[model samples]
Target: MPFIDLRAQYAALKPSIDARIQRVLDHGQYIMGPEVQELEQALAAYVGTQHCITVASGTEALLIALMTLDLQPGDEVITTPFTFAATAEVIVLLGGVPVFVDIEPDTLNIDPTQIEAAITPRTRAIMPVSLYGQVADMDAINAIAARHGGLPVIEDAAQSFGASYGGTAGTPRESGSAPRGKSCGLSTWGATSFFPSKPLGCYGDGGALFTNDAALAQAAREIRVHGQSQRYTHTRVGVGGRMDTLQCAIVLGKLERFDWEVAQRLAIGERYQRLIGDLPLQRLAVREDRDCVWAQFTVQVDHREAVIESLKQAGIPTAVHYPKPLHRQPAYEARSRAATPLPNAEAAARRVMSLPMSADLSEAQQDQVVAALRVALT
Candidate 1:
């Protein structure tokens, strides 16, 4: 009944994980070691991007990506209000205004339709978060960005690294598919987290930035190490954002069965949808063109607090993906402005609850959860 079941994943990949860690330890190059480059290359190839820059954390990934974009003070970045704080946190930290946009009711993703209206002359970028491991409508979003003089689109893909977009249903198109675009490869800049609970995670905090622009890639590389063009030549202002070598090695180990894990997550999420179909709740909508790896298998329920208490009594663990929208939060409300009414984001915050989910989630475990939920609702 572990919420994310990381222990099970570790048990499954122990041998490879142990070996990878051992290799890192033996080399004694903890900071920006060979494994770091190896992981960057592997992830770049997997994501089908020209460059992949690893950073200390998902926040660092977003921060570095924004830095590379030259986000100036008072610049605005339009993004959904429904995502984790990091989506907007980076923008605020960089002295950029985060213009809050509403999310789609069903998908809980940033509504592409609302984006254009939010774009003012100060708007510098569009940051669309791929919430709940499903990518937002990148095609439509990209088209909008193009219409507005090609505003850089930075996909905050923290929960969607292994997910695919624009693919035919039931296809194994992780990469090497012309028609399908991987989550991190779909935009100008895609930043993803390797936080332990993500679809693709490492042992500790880690994240990466992916982009096709070589100049931007070079800029990010320099920024991650205090803006070092060479050893001591400081090119520009930057942060200590490098993802250590050991974390990179752990991610490489996790990548060994990442494909299979993605498949399992998809299947498990579908089964959850089906099992909950008759329940008094709203299932998250997955678009026909894309898949959610179910970073968290979330659903909307009435009287969420009661349901949570009941499930807790039943020994079933559940969590709220978010309890409040960013615009309503204390830290962000005064700082960020809502470009559109965030009705969906607010409603979702009150209703959405995540059940225990992982690639390692068992059928029996899933059944137990559903049964408990059913009783809770009744």
Candidate 2:
């Protein structure tokens, strides 16, 4: 089975996708077209934020967000060591230091309790990753930030676009509704990816930054366009990070059915968890107040290499969300400083594995995967 069913998704959304792409073609404004502003407004409202700035890729979104904060040399940004390289890469690129912290064993998100101790005078921001589609503890993280004279908090929401936190259960707002607690609306800056495999993906690379700050929003807008405050007016140094018009149009089309897709993902993920419960593995822990879109339905299993080989032999596809912690990697090991011994991060990196997951994944396919995993464990 396909690990991520983008083909099936495209088949379902063909009509709207085609129409939007055709409109972009007709307008012939591939760079910063009307659809660009249209998507920005729609996503900002959907995220319950004052501004949403689209960028060329998820990495670019993180870079632009850091740029807006004016990250300087030797500045430290506290973040978990268990996330994708891009989370720390942007910090190192700007001549800043990334202080690595451990993750919660169950949630695999940054431990908020460990954040305050990591704070030093050079600490400029706290970037917590919402790994595998569940949001980190933003309320507690924000509280910690406030205690430290309000250090900026950036949510690395690249894997969690449709997720929500701290809202009453059973009361899901409509797709366009700007309910508080949405993933991209919960922090100082929320940066997410629209890479084809994400919950709300476009056809190609795209990402967005969400924030309630008006001045920061303006700053990001300028940064994405080579720091031009106006035409040919270079106010500050920036990068060419704007998302193209066609990609924005595609995302707009996908927005039409995003709510339904998110619902399917949640249900499928829960079903996967239920089916895997009786087996010999650990399922990811989702908290009571929040929801996961299951960007990848991940589980932790022993002897992962054997399990992967067995599953591969059975014609089932699997992946590791991450195989090693960032601090363990050569490039980052020398660059990042560990706040404490990341025992949880080390253990998780050794055992975590992901199964085939997508909104289009069927019950039968899920069952097949579970059955294969059962045999693999044996």
Candidate 3:
């Protein structure tokens, strides 16, 4: 089966997507068009944030967020070592230091307990990635940040845009009373990707930054457009980070079905966990208070290479979220301030494997993957 069934998704939303694209074409405002503002409004409303600033890419969203914070050289941003390279890359790119922290074995998110010890006078922000569609412990992280002079907490929510954190509010049940919902909205800043494969993806690269702070939102808006507070007025240093109009249209189209897609992802993830329970591998834990959107539906396995090979032979495709810890990466090795050993991150990098997952993934396809995995382990 295809790694991620974007084709199926497109087929389902063809009419709306076509109309949205056609409208953009008619307007001919390719750059920073009306759709961009419309999308920003929709996203801000969806996430319960006061403002949403669309950016060129998820990486840009993170970078712009940091720029708005006015991070300076030698300033530190504490983050997990187990996330995508872009999570920490933005920090180092701006001449800021990335302080590495380990992850929780179950959620594979940055461990909040380890964050305070890593904090220093130069620490400017705490960036925690919501890996594999599950949010990190933001309440505790926020508490820690509050204790430390209200340090900015940026949720690297590239994977967990739709996923909810029950701890902050409560959990939403299928039929029962809604558990309070909190995830991306639970931080000082939330950054999410609209890369085509994400749960809330657009047709191409697009992303957004969400925050309630009016000043930070204004700063991010400026940063997205070469730091121009007004036409040709450069207020601060910035990047060409504005999301294209066509991309914004695509995201708007995708948003129409996003709620259903999120439900499908949650259901499919639960099914995968249930069906694979009899297998020899270890499934990712979905905490009682939170759910994973299954951005990767990852599982821990021994001999991951062998398992992947077996699945590939059976016509199933799989991928890895990350293969190396940031501290071990050549680019960050010299720049990172990793005081403690990232044993969990390192072990997870070697063992974690993501299976083919999408709202469109079928039960038969899932069964085939499981059977192949069983034989591979044997």
The clash tally of candidate 3 reads 2
Q: lDDT values of the candidates? A: 0.93, 0.92, 0.88
TM-score of 2: 0.97
Q: Candidate 1: give the clashing pairs.
A: none
Residue-by-residue lDDT tens digits, candidate 1, 113-159: 99999999999999999999999988888888989999999999999
Model 2 lDDT per residue over 1-378, tens place: 999999999999999999999999998999999999999999988888889999999999999999999999999999999988999999999999999989999999999989999999999999999999999988788888888998999999999998977654334434543334789898889999999999999888999999999999999999999999998998989999999999999999999999999999989999998888899998999988788999989999999999999999999999997999999999899899999889999999999999999999999998899999999998
- What does candidate 2 score in Cα RMSD to the true structure? 3.0
- List runs of model 2 lying over 4 Å from the truth: 170-180
User: Which is superior by TM-score, 1 or 3?
Assistant: 1
The list of candidate 3 runs beyond 4 A from truth reads 167-182
Q: In terms of TM-score, how similar is model 1 to the real structure?
A: 0.97
Encode model 3's per-residue lDDT on 1-378: one tens digit a residue. 898999999999999999999999998999999999999999888888888999999999999999999999999999998999999899999999999989988778888899999999999999999999988877688889989999999999999888887644244434432224545677889999999998888878999999889999999999899999999999999899999999999999988988899889988999989988988877887777777888888999989998888888888898988888889999889999795679999999999999889999988888888788778889
- Total clashes, candidate 2? 0
